[model samples]
Target chain A: MAHAHESNTKRIWIVFGILSVVTIVEVILGIIKPESLMASVLGMKILNWIFIILTIVKAYYIAWSFMHLEGERGSFKWSIVLPLLILIPYLAFILLVEGNYIYDVYSESFVSWDF
Target chain B: MEATVNTQTEEENVWGGGNQPLGASYGKMMMWFFIVSDALTFSGFLVAYGFSRYKFIDSWPIADEVFTHFPFLHGVEAPMYYVALMTFILIFSSVTMVLAVDAGHQMKQKKVAWYMLFTIIGGLVFVGSQAWEWATFIRGDYGAVELRSGRILQFVDAQTGKRIALDEFAQPIEDERVVHLERNGVWYQSGEGLPSYTVNEIKAGFMANENVVGRAEKLNEDGEKIMLSREETAERLESAVHVVEGANLVRNEYGNRLFADFFFFITGFHGFHVFSGVVINVIIFFNVILGTYDRRKNYEMVEKVGLYWHFVDLVWVFVFTFFYLV
Candidate 1:
């Protein structure tokens, strides 16, 4: 029992190390503005896609490791994460696409509306 | 004697935990619900931000230029560093909270209390820093022009992301100024001219200037104000606009109407979470010192609170990416 718990402690620390590395990657990707990455990938801006993916990955580690969700039963774990997984992406897609449309509407016609 | 019950309330699972220990209670479930609601609130603000970004697709102030403050490096032009630091602070505190819970499981009272104290302090610091960030954002950055139609027209270098100021591009104020006619006529108290600077001032500078002045038109590719050609820059020197003072949603030195609104709403929502997290953490810290969880022997309370603390850090990851990175 003692050895098992010790190994868990070691594993948690490893997860922390991974999270730190991921955050560094995010910061670097944000700052560098690499043209190749900035170009379109998978139908979205590559940089934007990178930011979203890295954020979700970090959120996953926080939940599974830091919150000890990994120890939870599959049902319990999926209840929280699955709902968010389905809902958040749906929201993001709706808002992002709608936002682009609004931009189209706003830019199409120039009315001297500024007074 | 062993007790057994054949009947289980059907609604137990609906309103309460069905299989879990009763004394485990439902407070943590309630916390999850609150987090869900909070998440929705943040989404609403971010969606609004997207709406505004869509509106000013071309001329929107780039996020990178507006948020370039870092610690100990005064005016270092290090954008996104503060939010990154705030992210690390929140996550590290979460680490301490989880350690506290682990210590609690081992019944190390002193260690638990100490770790909880550190976590509480971290939450407080994050909230305070968020306030400072908000203050800097609310106070204008690059002064802008409120066009006659209420839309914002901000100056940008044609090639550089660098923002052009109204003053830099505007003609200098001269002795031969058009003092408000209302002052002499006393016939009408007209609402103030759109801004303090007169059209004549902007025109005078544009007419006299050599540097290209960008005329910010509507976001229409054709409408967008391009820099005057080298010769046109000199000819249009008299009409060049200067930076106007005061607050209007359309024209802030920082960029657009959407940026300010979203910055306040998103950060304010996040700040509120940190504030409440601190309060909850303080309560838990006091309970640890009072040995409440020690008496319970299970130490589950600390674990549940640890979940919440980590959740706050999780939300910040997305906030930082969307607001600062993407």
Candidate 2:
């Protein structure tokens, strides 16, 4: 915490390079959208899985480097990251499952939504 | 003496009154708390967006087809390029902000000012780009028809698999219907502005053009919009209730109305944050130019603002992925 006088120019540029390279990779993959990756692995496409994972990776780097979470103490870091770690996935799971169920109901109903 | 001894004993305990928790300053800890809560708010919105998308998974709009326009390349089919550029601008601005914080740590006022200026410019550019994106989305390149069942039907060239604009095919009608304004239409209820072309004109145009076909909002197994045959296109045209030109609260030329709704609300909220962030950065930039932080013997103010700017960039990373890419 006391290394206030040290120059962090090198570290900042390195992180910037990493972020830019990752973004470029994401854009390329999005544009190309290879057929193999488009196939479903589990409930979703492998390509979509790749995008979500890469986005998480980018988020990690941005939070750790740009927001200086790396310099913070263990307890401080956990306090911020832990609650979201638990809540976001749980919320996503519930909402998605419920949404799919609703779609099932709508599709099976007698009324034809379209003419 | 007794009171002083008791106070000293209390100060030695683990829950001491004056100690900072987790070795963080009061302001820093509060900022972290705010960030955590804000992150949850964003997640809630995103999760809702995901829920709605999943509910209408079959009929959702493909982001690539919808956001294909670039700034200067008219009629070009460059997909995801402009958004990618915008993402880069934002990330680079985050880098500049972190660098500004680093410079402040070294007490390098000149470097901090320069880096802050760069960050401000980047933020302004990003905000401007978002405005342009919203404008493009509102003034749709091609128009579509809204069916009676509240679904949109777009036109496409069956041969080239490209979208066709309403203006290109729809024949103008010589009807005497005038635009009803607030004062002339009714005493209290104002009539909405009528679209340029009526449904009859579009149906006639579709019938006349042999190459044009109507595509439904639903996606097939290949994640592409399902295009109806010429026979089906003619049948579907009978159900056209309104000619939808662009996005509004009720109807959107792009498949799902909810998509436009979420796009507006979530991005609008995020844009508001970026706008406020720019205004804050400008004030801080002026302060740096005036040597206020220097006179205070510490540049923690820059670091604090840098945290906020980085958080904004962080939110955008997720927004870019969920809204544009995934």
Which candidate ranks first by TM-score, i.e. highest? 2
Residue A95, model 2, lDDT: 100
Q: Write the per-residue lDDT of candidate 1 for residues B1-326, one digit (tens) a residue.
A: 11123124433464564644332236665665566666666666666676666656676656676787665676578877787788888888888888887787677899989999999989988888887777666554555654444444455565663666667766767665454675588776655445545656656655565453444533444223444354543343333353455343444555455666677767777788788888888888889889898788656678778877887887788788878887
What is model 2's interface RMSD? 1.0
Cα lDDT tens digits for candidate 1, A29-90:
87887878756776558888878888888888888888777766575566666776777668
| Candidate 2: tens digits of C-alpha lDDT, residues A1-115 | 4444788789888988998888999999999999889888878999999989988998998899889898887999999999999999999999999999988887899988777
Question: So what's the TM-score on candidate 1?
Answer: 0.78
lDDT of 2 by residue, B56-166 (tens): 988899999889999999989999999899999999999999999989988889999999999999999999999999999988889999888898999999999889999
**Model 1 residue A103 lDDT?**
66
TM-score of chain A of 2: 0.93
DockQ score of each predicted structure, in the order shown:
0.46, 0.85
Docking class of 1: acceptable
Task: Quote the lDDT for A37 in model 1.
Answer: 75
What C-alpha lDDT, on a 0 to 100 scale, does residue B131 get in candidate 1?
77
